[model samples]
Target: MPDFSFDRLRRHPDVEAENLFAVDASDRLILDEAAADLAAAGPGEVVVLEDHYGALTLGAAALHGARGIRTHQDGLSGEQALARNAAESGLAEAYRSLPLGEELLAGARVVLLQLPRSLSALDELADAVRRFASPHVRVFAGGRIKHMTIAMNEVLGRHFGELQVSPARQKSRVLIASAPLPVTDAPAWPRVARHDDLAPGLSLTVCAHGAAFAGTTIDIGTRFLLEFLDRMKPDAGSAIDLGCGTGVLAAALARRRPGLRLIATDQSAAAVASARATMEANGVTDRVRVVRDDALGSRPDASAELIVLNPPFHIGSSVHAGIALKLFEDAARVLRPGGELWTVWNTHLGYRPALTRIVGPTHQVARNAKFTVTVSTR
Candidate 1:
């Protein structure tokens, strides 16, 4: 058996800091417990979900000799890191990335799951497993004990008949669930909700995939940013909703100023799908374009006159600013000279300095007890 080590893992193109890590004890625990079954499985029988890097997938392939593993990661950065780590470890052929749907779970007998913190995300995963995975599939869902909750067990219970929880080891635990139950109800994903008071004379229909932040409801930060929509230059030709979660900013912009061409982009596949659904529900599909990308990586530089952002302050449970700063740089690159970048962030983050340094001159547009909205010129 080959020795699997986390030292080989990397978070390339993502903000890497000393406090952050690519792999943790939970990955090792899951791989160790499932090593026997995985080693006995044939090609394509194993599936991995939400792998932070390539720890579980590559460990199963390299150390346990599992073959033809399929995997799904919601974040583009996670997918990119997995590929890079696999290549560096010479395990590139061990697994393949697929969307979180039937294709990824079809016929999978053993699923290695890194438990998501969101119950809605867990519901979506459980639904797919019950509907698509093999009848006897065993799901090994594990996470840090601090992040695990009783609600997660309930979510899995809805899909699997037997649930066995492992005693905590190294501050991590695994839930072993088997015996798929029949679920005839339609999936609860892409949830739709109406917000009547988001703005005056405006009712925004928000569509959210299971993993999307602030699902089907507007966040206070965004609601604050909405206050300044009318303040943007009237003649700005085009705009972008950088890091658009559910296309709230983009849809609102389109609705407020009818003829504006708005593009919404996010790295999460779920976010892109949700944003598109939101646009259609709001009847702005023709004006708002949704794309899954890593911080405007797919968009041309200096092509837009205005951009809006509500950047995420965390990365995989760690309160890190790498993701937020990356978005700021992206916004700076995408905005034309003298273009405006509107942003909302937590006041404690003190992102104003970064905005000034990265985007150009920055000024406070609005602030409340907890949030601050700023406008930066490119």
Candidate 2:
């Protein structure tokens, strides 16, 4: 452990609160477990994946003397936070951000990963490491103990020949994997699934990359929200899908209303990729534009006529309303006067009041035992 201060790290450009943090025990444990390998590796031979904020990448660079590091973060917010932290720490030259592809992993001898909660995401990451990285690459993946499961080891085992479990420390643990297995088949990401039952005479070809939320399946909340597709302002010419995952809602809207223009946007790289693929698969690419954005951050204020959202309630793993509220505020900013913001949420969250205060007068459109769909005027 060098003198680098994890305490100095901040999760700016992300929803921040007393409970949400930029670094965690798992980050420190991962760096400590890989310190020897990181120090031994040459410059440009280190790669960091799924680093939430700058902990793993910056720690490896500033603390372990690793340089020319390649990093990939699924979330745009995390990527921005890393850049800000790197500049503030005067280590901006140590690492570069890249996509989750061969360029990021090529010839890499050491990899530090912050384990994702999705098994499909882990599988895709492990497969890429084995397929693209150096044969001798050593992967150190860490996560909180409560979020770790035996299934994760199995996912890694499918891509690596050896797996070593480190002793848990401070309720965190790491998995060391080496001996990359030969990949024979095509990459298994951007999975495609078709649904004909969503609505009568309406079928969706949903595509999802591994890290995309809800994978290729339509979540119950989104499905519930889609029930009101006909009820959305019929004369609206354009719409934005805020936090769009897999472009399910966007594709559905495009299919139902052939003349309407659609924009699907999300912060996650995987989600943006998945949404683009989905739009293309559904033959809606001409009418739908998919973008990687942080909650309509790139959209002009008072430009959108209608917006659809299924805002996430969690910031990272903790249940919080800050993220949802932030989305609401952004939606309010983007929607034109008298425009509509239709959203779906968990019934228990009781977001109607927040929606009313942030967007405009809100009214529930529909509610089931589990989810509630609402419409707010802007």
Q: Using TM-score as the measure, which candidate wins? A: 2
TM-score of every model versus the real structure:
0.97, 0.98
C-alpha lDDT score of every prediction, in listed order: 0.90, 0.94
Best by lDDT: 2
Residue 232 Cα positional deviation in candidate 2, in Å, after optimal superposition:
0.9
Tens digit per residue, CA lDDT, model 1, 5-77: 6787888867888998899999998987777779777899999999988899988988889889999998898
Question: Where in model 2 is the C-alpha error above 4 Å?
Answer: 1-4
Clashing pairs in 2: none
lDDT of 2 by residue, 1-378 (tens): 334579999999998888899999999999999999999999999999999999999999888999999999999999999999988888888999999999999999999999999999999999999999999999999999999999999999999999999999999999999999987999888899999879667889999989999998899999898888878988999999999989999999999999899999999999999999999999999999999888888999999999999999888899999989989999999999999999999999999999999999999998899999999998
